[model samples]
Target: MSIELGVLVAIAGLVISYLAYQLTHIKEVKTDSQENAEVKAELGYIRRGVDDIKIDLRANEKQISQMGERITRVEESTKQAHRRIDQLKGGDQ
Candidate 1:
């Protein structure tokens, strides 16, 4: 009977240990899940911010190109005016 009693106690101890391990594991998993959700939310916000920046960059690039074209036109107009002035002065000579 003592041997049987010892065996029962050992079994109960093992079961209790297993239950404790399971409880700790469950708590860790739940914490990890919550953290994962928060990370995903933050990542989504970052993604949207990056996308907005990209759009702004594209708009800036378009404005720069338009400015470059206007500058080119101004330069061409100046060159034409200089040539006309030179022709007029040569004719007077």
Candidate 2:
């Protein structure tokens, strides 16, 4: 009878210790407000970055459009110069 009681006490002690260890190691859960705040902060940063990219993209597009206009002017000038050269050659001939 004495040994049986000792065995039961030891088992109870082990179970209590395991529960204590689990409680100590349990992870804390974040509240919804905290989670939402963090998500909103991250989203704000991403939104700002996207806006910056859009500004840069618009500037790049404008520059590319200006370059195309310049190229068209240059081509017209080159064609005129070629025609003048051909006239000079015919006169020389």
TM-score leader: 1
Model 1 clash pairs are none
Writing each residue's lDDT as its tens digit, candidate 2 over 1-93 gives 989999999999999999987776653234556788999999999999999999999999999999999999999999999999999999999
Relative to the true structure, candidate 2 reaches a TM of 0.66
Off by over 4 Å in 2: 1-30
lDDT tens readout by residue for model 1, 2-93? 99999999999999999999999999999999999999999999999999999999999999999999999999999999999999999999
lDDT (CA) per prediction: 1.00, 0.92
Error of 1 at 78 (Å): 0.7
Clashing pairs in 2: none
CA displacement after TM-score superposition, residue 66 of candidate 2 (Å): 0.3
TM-score for each predicted model, relative to the true structure? 0.85, 0.66
